[model samples]
Target: MTNTHQRPLRILLAKLGMDTHTVGITIIAHALREAGMEVIFTGLKQTPEMVAAAAIQEDVDVVGISTLSAGHTRNLPKLARLLREAGAGDKLLLAGGVIPEEDRPLLEEAGVDRTFTMGSDTRDIVAYLNEWWAQQLAADA
Candidate 1:
């Protein structure tokens, strides 16, 4: 779906912390790009602050984090707070990886807007973001 913004939605995807995984995020990046959103991949070993800085620099509409290590509990919240401090807190923050179901609520409490476990459908992720963008536009209108 298209919006009145007149530009494709921009998304920044990052592999934060010590997580060496890239396959899942790469696939997601391709899917989001295919859906007509501008996708930026930050590669591996990114700190939360670095990701936040890049997100602001890129003027992205969303910040998607892919984590597979235990550092998520430590990093996601820091990134969330950093975004708010940078005055970019309104950007959608999404996390997807090997996160356990029990920890999903914790991430949400820490400012993550959504959590998708491993094997989540890329189509669902795209649809969710599009729906969210539509809602944001409606709210702005």
Candidate 2:
């Protein structure tokens, strides 16, 4: 959180499935970078497997999914499973977009570290990442 590691938090963002509405995703990516984190946008129409593989291959600190469709209800858990299968389950799994409040609990149960739904502020998200990262560092220590 204090930039003690020299390298910024590496984040990989992806949109799984055929939905190509990337406006929200791109905004998040830019906001995160502006907040001093390294971001990797994996683009639209990516499969869950590709997202997971890229996350592991890129050695990212977090894997973020941007969803605007109902597919997340099914795809999110699958991505979590794939990450777990690839031994990267412990890494942070973040998602944000137009997800419904009714589905948030399900996402958490499916292994999502956090979900920033509609109306969530970028400042709050940035603060959360700072706090969360600090906690991780302390826990490791």
Candidate 3:
């Protein structure tokens, strides 16, 4: 169902693997909601399979995974591969939290659409998703 007040963007926000940083994900969820998007938070320590399943079940446009435990290299790629295998690779994949600058290019190469560093504004994430949604719709058309 569409939201009348604003274009609805469904998002599944989760923490991958053993990463326990919930503060950033919580803040992002609040920001997305404030921006008129629907958000589903999957809480901490989520497996790649569970994340992909949630994204499919929820039919979310975006899947945001937070990796503060330095597992982005290992986890993000595996998650992307899993999503692809599940036929949800078209869904946007975004990551944040303690991501080092040097790893950005590698993560992008690994199919992560966007990466946010510490101190980046929440509004930036909201705007990125909105733009991404628009682009996806255009591409589909």
Candidate 4:
């Protein structure tokens, strides 16, 4: 995939709320990096505010939150609101880990651009990101 920007696509991956799970997000970080994307892993125990601030300060193209503690309904929307409030409404917002099929609409209504359920292929994630980025570049062009 061709990156319109000189630098690789920048993405911020975070562990939101009280979720202690890191294995999935770690693997994702590695996969994104391997795909030549610049990844900023915010470690664990990040708040919606912190992630939003990092996303804006880092000028990332995407923000991904990983949760396995059932905080998706609460945290994802908060982060989305914060990002929009900070004028980053265009940044792709993604949720991963343990999200139920039923809650998908709530998340979408709250401005989450995508969700990757548990066991989602990292290759598919990479392809999705690349495709999304390409579309954004095309739109701009």
Give the number of the best model, judged by TM-score: 4
Give model 2's TM-score versus the native structure: 0.92
lDDT of each: 0.89, 0.86, 0.86, 0.91
Model 2, span 1-141: residue lDDT tens:
233354577889899999787888888888889999989989789999999999999888889898888789999999999999999998899988888989989999999989998678888988888787777677655
Instruction: Give the TM-score of each candidate.
Output: 0.93, 0.92, 0.91, 0.94
- Rank ordering of all candidates by TM-score, starting from the highest: 4, 1, 2, 3
Give one digit per residue, the lDDT tens place, for model 1 in 8-115: 789999999889888889899999999999999887899998999999998888999998887888899999999999999889999999898888888899899999
lDDT of candidate 4 over 18-115, digit per residue (tens)? 89999999999999999999999887889999999999898898999998999999989999999999999989999999999999999999999999
lDDT of 3 at 53: 91
Q: Rank the candidate models, highest lDDT first.
A: 4, 1, 2, 3
Between the candidate structures 1 and 2, which one is better when assessed by lDDT? 1
